[model samples]
Target: MVQPAPYLLGRFLDPIFAIGVGTLSYIQYERNTHREPGHTLYDLLQKKFFATKEQTQEKK
Candidate 1:
């Protein structure tokens, strides 16, 4: 007797998708969490991740 089997591609993708979305939401939640210092989130990301600091600085 033979048994039915599942496809390999779907199994691989399921965990990848779950972890990807979970990590993204977790980061977003942490980003909004409380802070001990007086600083906006825009500043924090720049210091930590080296992310973009300024989009458009006004002319002097």
Candidate 2:
């Protein structure tokens, strides 16, 4: 009637993982609240990754 090592390890680590995720979410919330009115982290990343030719020209 003994559980395997992986199962025991998962049970022990689940709480830690949840806490880490919660902390990251809180930090993201704080950052978003203080950002400029029309921009977000996702928008910045999207513009960086998928900029149009005109957008690129404007930067130069």
Q: Highest lDDT, which number? A: 2
Per residue, candidate 2 scores C-alpha lDDT tens digits across 1-60 of 998556534886978888888978965995967977547656776798988999999999
Q: How badly does each model clash, as a count of residue pairs?
A: 0, 0
Candidates in order, TM-scores: namely 0.40, 0.43
Q: After superposition, how far is residue 29 of candidate 1 from its true place, in Å?
A: 0.4
Q: What lDDT does candidate 2 reach at residue 54?
A: 95
lDDT of 2: 0.78
Structure candidate 2, residue pairs in collision: none
TM-score of 2: 0.43
Candidate 1: 10-residue stretch with minimal lDDT: 51-60
